[model samples]
Target: MAVVTTAVRSGLLFPLFLLSIDASFQRKSGTKTQNIGSFWNGSTGRSERGTELSCCALINVQMRQVFPIHAQQTRPKKECRDRLVQYNDQLDAVLGELEHHPEILLRAVVADGQYAKDLFVETVTGHGFALISKLQRNANLNYVYDGPDQQRRGPKRKHDGKVTFADLSRFDVVNESAAERILTQVVWGVRWKRLLRVVVIQVLDHHGQVIKYAVLFSTDITMSASEVVALYRSRFEIEYVFRDGKQFLGLQDAQMRTQQALESHWNLTLLVMNLARLEALRANNGAQTLVFGVEDLKRRAYNALFAQVILVNLGLEARFEELIANPSGPLNFGLKAA
Candidate 1:
């Protein structure tokens, strides 16, 4: 919460937040690690034995910054088998935490296809926030009945017919280009048993043939199709948070065995990453777009620390300002050129 307040003061966060919910697996060795369970590792393209962390992150769409608000270790269903540790259950906890911060106006919750289930959708929408997520290409959907109600039937008509991508006569073409065609419609999800704003993107080949396609949906039927697509694309930014936390920070290098210690370590690693990025943004004068290099920041920090040690040992601390002013001084050594 302090970090979020700092971001708000720095003008880095917008009023309308786009929250992303996802999970990442960290491979750990040894039997002493608490809550360690097998999970699917996307980097390896297969399921591996590891611990999973489910995170809810806020994405600054304009600045392209991702800040993790909350994260918790998720145990495999086959092991702990408790509903409280399930994905949707963890999401409820995240939402509950956000409820205390009324200043954060969450516009929508974005996620991938794995979270497109009925419970997840209902959980997000129940909080009065829209949900933008991908749908399986072969999901069962039907066109809403627009004709007259059944005058002689016990129940009212609901579905006109099944929806087919090959025949999009019922959908409106909202966007079109040489590369793809975007169509949208308010259709009924057969599995979810609810109306959804569905968007379909048809990727075109060199000859304009649809070689591939993808389906996206939003719980808010009033949301624009383009906005839904853009929000869903921003969901990928959370993956970068995980990538940086593991590769640059010591997200997976924690030696802690206890659950409390491991959770603290993981959150600290992510918090440090966020702070470093925030410092970079400040140094750049809060530019709308700037290049961020965690490696370069680390190098500068190391150089400064080394210089401080040398200055203190040589009793030249009084001349620190003068020495640092030189372009080729020790304080600037090993620092990346701007």
Candidate 2:
């Protein structure tokens, strides 16, 4: 229940277009461990074979505020004494919270390949939200038949053939590299039980040979292929949040043992992130176009605290926020002596 139960912004509320959620792991290695479990630490690009707390954080599309709504310590299958819970169950809890609050107006959920499974897709869609994520490179997809059928058939043609890069046709070209080495395709994903829209982006060498490609899809087939690619691309916003939280905000700095302590520390870090944003926005007079950031807010806070100490020692009755907002202004250090 750490979810934000109140509106984040003021005036002319807009529909929340995208909500990006992903798990962040804290690497832990110690003698005494309680709820610690081995989890994937993406920052290291390798499996963290030690105890880690898998935290799920949700971010607004514009990177306005990030909320760590749910977190559970990952438990290794062999060491787990009780039933092991997956990200899907935690994500369901998050979606369920949003469902009760219609004012949030969440339209779609954006995540990485980790959440591209059928269970996650069905769970997200069940909450009336579209799932935007990438499919594995070797995904088993088949083209559904829409062509004229032959009378001689038993189960009928469920698939045209195995879909490969060479045989796929591009319905529309979404992007082209300046060097003419990359092409993005938006086409119907054939061969799957459910009709889906897929985006195939291929990078070719100078010889026009396929070097790399990405296949992104959306459960809400009505969305254009371009929209699918864009939404999936925005999923990285949460990744950036994790990076900032770790590097600047000390997201992975805690070393608590109990579940309550671990959860509290994780939630507190995310709460600080949101509070910094809220403070920054207020500092900018609620202007979304401003360039204020969390670091800047931290810097201002440091100055404000220093100025408050100085003002209190001098028996001054002036506002410390003015000094914080404009440290070099006349009111801060230029005030006339009594």
- Per-residue lDDT tens digits for candidate 2, residues 1-338, read 22343424453113354766677777666757665656666768886655555555555555344555566665566776422246677778888877776557676888888777777777888888888888887776665556778799587666565556565663457566633332343234433346666677777677767777787788787887666766677666666566767778887777777767777777687777766655555555543564434555565556567777788998873866565456456332432231
Model 1 residue 190 lDDT score: 88
Candidate 2 scores a C-alpha RMSD against the true structure in Å of 5.7
Instruction: List candidate 1 segments past 4 Å from native.
Output: 82-85, 148-156, 299-338
- lDDT (C-alpha, whole model) for all candidates: 0.81, 0.63
Q: How many clashes would you count in candidate 2?
A: 5
TM-scores of the candidates are 0.86, 0.79
User: In lDDT terms, how accurate is model 2?
Assistant: 0.63
Cα deviation at 189, candidate 1, in Å, is 1.5
lDDT of 1 by residue, 1-338 (tens): 66766776767666467888888888798887878767889999998887887888887766657788777788767767753338788787788788888777788899898889878888998888888999987889999988976669488888899998888888999999999999999999889788899999999988999999999999899998998888888888898888878877878887887778877888888788778877877766663765565666777778877777888999987877776577666654665563
